[model samples]
Target chain A: MKKRAQEVERALDVLLPLPEGPEKRLIEAMRYAVLGGGKRLRGFLVMEVASLFSVAPACAARVAASVEMLHAYSLVHDDLPAMDDDDLRRGQPSCHKAFDEATAILAGDALLTRAFEVLVDVDTHSDSQARCELVAALGAASGARGMVGGQMIDMLSEGQDLSGAEVTRLQALKTGRLIQYSAEAGAILGRAPSHQRHLIAAFGRDLGAAFQIADDILDTEGTAEEIGKTAGKDEAAGKATMVSIMGLEQARAHASMLAEQAANYLSSFGEKAANLVALTDFVVSRRS
Target chain B: MKKRAQEVERALDVLLPLPEGPEKRLIEAMRYAVLGGGKRLRGFLVMEVASLFSVAPACAARVAASVEMLHAYSLVHDDLPAMDDDDLRRGQPSCHKAFDEATAILAGDALLTRAFEVLVDVDTHSDSQARCELVAALGAASGARGMVGGQMIDMLSEGQDLSGAEVTRLQALKTGRLIQYSAEAGAILGRAPSHQRHLIAAFGRDLGAAFQIADDILDTEGTAEEIGKTAGKDEAAGKATMVSIMGLEQARAHASMLAEQAANYLSSFGEKAANLVALTDFVVSRRS
Candidate 1:
């Protein structure tokens, strides 16, 4: 997983070189927001899933980098004063804090646009069909009905009582879709069979649920240094989460169950998906 | 032109119907920001250029609507308090004014994502290559080195002295690239020959230059009622513009010259490009 993260970090550097223009600051902000940060869990998922199909590492790295770019854009925008207003991310100042709010916003916008641009490039996939599918799938995962829509629900549900089902649906849309897309991307690139793709997608969905619940737990228990950002922010903001609705112990139990279920979906792949299975365990039990 | 605008409006409505969910408000903000507004110059450019190659109207309309969606997204984000801070757009309250800042930002992000989504759909083009080309071109035009880059420069250059050349480069990145893409989109959709595509791109480039100068002139001369938004906000914000630097008369003369030059680039198409040539004149002369 660390190796895959390093490869994705290098890929991101190549994809987002600083240009010689007035917009260099924007590019710099984008690089700062994305490069050398995060657990790269999504990147690792893309590479691992692609490896199951024996896909080219370079191609997988490109997709992984694109996902990271999209994720970074989301984080940059989410930290804006109008949104979560986070001042720190990954142990450093957030994009809006590092740069001015306007630059941060433009950086996020440009990063999102660049993510699509990278996916559609010929280098990402020789086949135009695969490239188009990547663009379409990413759009579907990140657009109104997916990540962005999930964010909308998150913002609206703040300080409001939400049932467990409502919270699950919200988390599924907000973050699960992108994580699901990260896993399904390998299937699309490798032209995996429909049934196999469905299995991988299900694996991603369950894994994402487990990941979010674990995140909620971390927010509840981890420190600022351990988590790399503000801890207990969800509780402070009155944001609805599984931990908020079900108590810490119940949430942790549910996350563990979901993680195990996520790993079981890869049973058909046998030893080929061992690392992915291990990842499921890591997501639920990791300290950070 | 009005007919094409209406067609594009209908296409947008079809592409972005509100869903029954918590995110419905986000979609509503997106719809409100895009529908029944603007001169639809970019949409008309796509249709007219597509008509020159006898492309299907349905296909052309889809591309037109996508361009408008992208344009609308830029407008929504640009109007945010952190950016341009305008409360009015197209004679109505802007997205942030009507809804909220967070919703407006998400709506802009979703609109941009949806624009690419629509482009990649099979309904937009039967050939995946064409859809990929559209995606790549739009991404190139709107990404960091394109419209978003231009916005970054615009923000950084506010209240700063800039040379005429610097200002031209800024505007070219900010607005010209997207306008160029809109005209070139028809060629991409129609699968025009490379030479023909280049010609259309050149025409669009010059036309966009003319259109921006005219807009600067409008900001200098017209009222909010005439222009459908705050007219003199540019000068008020101390924003760098051609009219601010070159003065009204020289700017008008330059715009007219560019319009003529833009029309001449479409000379190879002869009468088939009459409407496009007429558009160059209309853009420079229109009050709004």
Candidate 2:
């Protein structure tokens, strides 16, 4: 994960350099939000899933980078004062806090557009069909039917009681779809068989669900020092989450079961799936 | 123009229906921002340019709708309190005013993502290569290097003195590139020859410049009722523009000259370019 994160960082640095103009702040905010970032778990998923098919590292890296860009754009917008109003992200000032709201908004917009630009570029894949497929999947994962829809629900549901099923659907769209795309993208890149692609996508779906449950768990149980950003936010906001509906112990148990199921979904590949299996375990175990 | 605008409105209505769920707000804001207004100049450019090559109207309409989606997203963001802070758009409340700020932001984000989604879909073009090319072109025109970059400059240069050349470069990136893409998209859809594509793109470049200049003139001379939004905003914001840099008379002359130059770029196409030629004239003459 560390190595893959570094590779993604380098790729982003190359992909988004500071232009020699006043608009340099846009690139700066984009880099600030994207680089020196999160666990790069999404990028790791793409690379590991692709590695199962021995997909070219460079090709996988670009795909990984594109997902990371999309993820970062989401984070930027999620932190906006009008959104979650976050001031810190990954223990640093959020993009809006680091560079004013307008620049952050534009930076997020640019990064989102850049993600598709990177995906469609010939450098990412030689086949235009593969490129278009990636573009289509990312759109499906991130647009209104997916992440954006999930976010809208998250906002509207605040302080409102939500059942476990509703929250599950919310989390599934909000973050799971992107995570699923991240995991399944490598198969598309490698032209893995449809059965293999479905297996990988299923693993991603379970893992992503577990990942969100873990996040809720951390938000409920961890401190700011451990989790970064403000902890206890979900509860304070009366946000409905796995932890809120299922309780901590049940959520923890559910996450453990999901992690195991996620790993089992990858079992078809046998030993080649070791890294992914471990990553699944890591998702539930993560503190931040 | 009215006919083309109506087609775009219908296309958007079909493209962005209010889904049953909490996300309906996001779609509401998207529809409210996109439908029922605007000159549809970009869509007109697209259809007219495509018509020159005898491209199918359905295919061209989709491309036009995609470009308009992008334009609407930009307008939504630009009206944010953190950005331009305008309360009015197209004679109606801005997205943030009509819907709360968070919904507006997500709506804009969704629209931007939707633009690429629309372009990459197979319905837009049977050839994956053509769809990918459209995706790439839209990204190039609207991402950090284009509209977003221009917006960044606009924000940074606010309240600061900017030369005429700097303002031109800013406008070119901000609006010119998308207009260029709007004109060039039909070529991509029809797989026009390289020389032909360049000709259309150049015409778009000149027309886009003239279009921005017309916007500045409208801001300077028209009333809010006449222009459908707050007029004289440029001078009020102390925003640097062609009109500010070149004076009203010179700016008008420059725009007139550009309309001619833009039309001349299509001279090779002769009678086939009649719609495009008239559209350039309409761009400069439109009040809203």
* Candidate 1 chain B, poorest ten consecutive residues by summed lDDT: B121-130
Place model 2 in a CAPRI quality band.
high
**What is the per-residue lDDT of model 2 for residues B1-288, given as tens digits with 9 covering 90 to 100?**
778777777787878878888888889889988884888888888888888888888878888999999999999999999999999999999999999999999999999999999888736445888999999999999999999999999988888999999999999999899999999998888789999999999999999999999999999999999898889888888889999999999999999999899999999999988888998898888877
Q: Which window of 10 residues has the lowest lDDT sum in candidate 2 chain B?
A: B120-129
TM-score of 1: 0.98
**lDDT per residue (tens digit) for residues A41-155 in model 2:** 9999988888998888888898899999999999999999999999989999999998899999999999999999999983544588889989999999999999999999999
**Candidate 2 lDDT (Cα, 0 to 1):** 0.91
DockQ of each: 0.92, 0.92
lDDT of 1: 0.92
Poorest 10 consecutive residues by lDDT, candidate 2 chain A: A121-130
In Å, residue B99's CA in model 1 sits off its true spot by 0.8
The total of clashing pairs for model 1 equals 0
> In candidate 1, which residue pairs clash?
none
Candidates' TM-scores?
0.98, 0.99
Q: Where in model 2 is the C-alpha error above 4 Å?
A: A122-125, B122-125
For every candidate, C-alpha RMSD to the true structure in Å: 1.1, 1.1
